[model samples]
Target: MDEVAGAIADPVRREILVLLRDSRLSAGEIAGRFEISRPAVSRHLRVLRECGLVRDEVVGRQRFYLLDPAPLADLAGWLGALLRPSGWEHHLDALETEVHRTRRERRADRREENTA
Candidate 1:
């Protein structure tokens, strides 16, 4: 996970992953999409590859890169557990609403007592 975080920490690397998400692209093709040098793009690809976020294939002389979804799926699974609504959330919300309602009722009673 730390490796994945480090790989995605760079904006350029994140963009590279986005480019590779839908289609495989050669390094030259990726480098062309950015203003940065091909060497720079290669470095980003290396980080992504090392972290298992991307995979590369050498077809003839050209090296193609594509997104590897397994790591992202693992990330999603972790996040889903954290984000899924717990049954207690509804009860907590109801409790909060009841507390506010009780406060309002007390204030109204105090106002009526003062007037009387």
Candidate 2:
């Protein structure tokens, strides 16, 4: 759990995981999406790999990264177990949904204000 926690502690690594959740990507491709250097991205990938959140395979000369969701499931299970206090999960879910809806409404209001 230490590795999983460590891997998820970084926002950049989380974004990388989200990207790889859809499909595999090369180190260069991942680096291209950020302002950080290639070596920095490589280091982030290394941490992710060590945590078992991601797996890298060397095909020819390039390294490609793939997401491993099993660790995520483990993490979620642990968190769920820890947060089972008086049905807090449902409250949290409702809070999240409301926050997202509020954000969408704010964006729409901003767009309308801008257009007028």
Candidate 3:
């Protein structure tokens, strides 16, 4: 779980996962989308592979990467268990909605005050 979290904590790795979610891609293809070097992208791929979030296959001379998704499922299950038992997630969601509403109301009030 720690490894999975660590792998996904990086924005670049998350984007990589998004890219691979739809289709498999070669290392060069993945690297092409970013400004980073091929080696840097390879390192991100390595971390994802280590965390079981991605898998690579050697086809011909190039390596292709695809999302495994099992580890993410496991993480989701773990988080669901933690959130459901305590009911904290429900409370958090409610609080978030309330905060958004309050912010919107404040903005409206300020606009009216300025117009007046």
- Relative to the unseen true structure, what is the C-alpha lDDT of residue 101 in candidate 3, on a scale of 0 to 100? 100
Q: TM-score of each candidate?
A: 0.71, 0.70, 0.69
Query: Which whole-number lDDT from 0 to 100 does residue 48 have in model 1?
Result: 92
lDDT per residue for candidate 2 within 1-116, as digits (tens), equals: 87898889999999999999999999999999999998999999999998889999999998899999888887898898887756677799889999999999999999999999
Model 3, runs deviating above 4 Å: 85-116
Better of 1 and 3 by TM-score: 1
Q: Which order, best to worst by lDDT?
A: 3, 2, 1
Give the lDDT of residue 67 in candidate 3: 98
List of clashing residue pairs for candidate 2: none
Residues 1-116 of candidate 3: C-alpha lDDT, one tens digit per residue:
87898899999999999999999999999999999998999999999999999999999998899999999887898888876735777899889999999999999999999999
Q: Local distance difference test, per candidate?
A: 0.90, 0.92, 0.93
**Global Cα lDDT for candidate 3:** 0.93
Worst 10 residues of 1 by lDDT: 69-78
Candidate 2 overall Cα lDDT vs. reference? 0.92
